[model samples]
Target: MADELKRRLVHSSGAGLVALYLLADYFELGLTWPRFQVLMVVLAVGTIGLEFLRLQVGLDWQIYDKLTRDYEQDQFAGYGYYMVSMTVAVLLFDPQIALPAMLMLAIGDPISGAVSDDSLKFVKGPKVLVTMFVVSAIIAAPFLFEYPLAVLAAALGATIADGIKVRIGDYIVDDNLTIPIYASLLAWVVIEFVPV
Candidate 1:
């Protein structure tokens, strides 16, 4: 339980990326869109490299033992997916859509994890799914107030991403990879086509 809480705490810390971007933009620190994209890309690349080192070269770090789940022992971990998803969101979507999407992953996922039953390793129960959707919607509301449809779409995307586990052969599609991507894509589609 302690390890799970620690993992969730670490997961929630992903929001720092959004906070940093906001602060830099608000204060005119020159973190323009391109620079922000570069930052996310760099983080994704670094995380991927670290995963390679950990999985390929057998780097048995202590933190890995504490934070990683049994399933992650033989595959890419969630942190790598988290960074990649955030990078993808920032690169592919407008900030109005992407930042809230990232927050949905960072904040909503952890909140769902807190309420989820650990015994069910794959799909969470209905209550957890509801929690995920509500939290995601609330996270997106501030950023997408003008487009209620977009907000609901993003929340639904994030909830679906977190609530279910999709498998391809031996690999499960981690929610950390899908959450921001799903949210951003859905939000973008609604914002683009649906009349405000």
Candidate 2:
């Protein structure tokens, strides 16, 4: 239960990035795209540094080791993946593509995990996909009002990406990295050509 709570807390915090960006826009907080991009890059750098330390020290700074199985292994962790994905979205894509991309993974993945499959392995459940698409589309509605096709594509792409976890040699590519990138690419493509 604690693990679940912690997972959701971290997930929600990531989703809150969307709110942060939106609030910054509404209040004219001077968070230009370049500034936000630089902030994300700095964050990624810090996270990578901490990951290196975590690899060397092993549990010295692992406060959540007891919470989730994700932290149990002696390897690079998902928090870094999550941070990198979010950073890449903001840095590489426009706000139209980036914000929903972040939210799709941030909000959609946890919902998929809670009801779909909790196993480390990838499992594509039809109900899970549906749930993810619906939730993501709803979450993205406000931002993607002008592009229905792009909205659906983003939701579908993220959900599908979440269903597949890949392993390259010794490393595990968690959905945390894939979903945002895939969704952003899919949505950006759709928006670019769909006469929106």
Per-model C-alpha lDDT, please? 0.92, 0.80
Residues 1-196 of candidate 2 have per-residue lDDT tens digits of: 7778687678767877778778998999997878888888898889878878777776365575743355535666677888899899898889988898888888888887778756665567788778888888887677787899988888877977887667799666778888889888888889888786
lDDT of 1 by residue, 123-159 (tens): 7899999999999999999999999999999999999
Error of 1 at 44 (Å): 0.4
Clashes in model 2: which pairs? none
TM-score of each: 0.96, 0.90
Q: Which ten residues in a row have the lowest lDDT in candidate 2?
A: 64-73
Q: How well does candidate 1 score on lDDT at residue 161?
A: 95
In lDDT terms, which candidate is top?
1
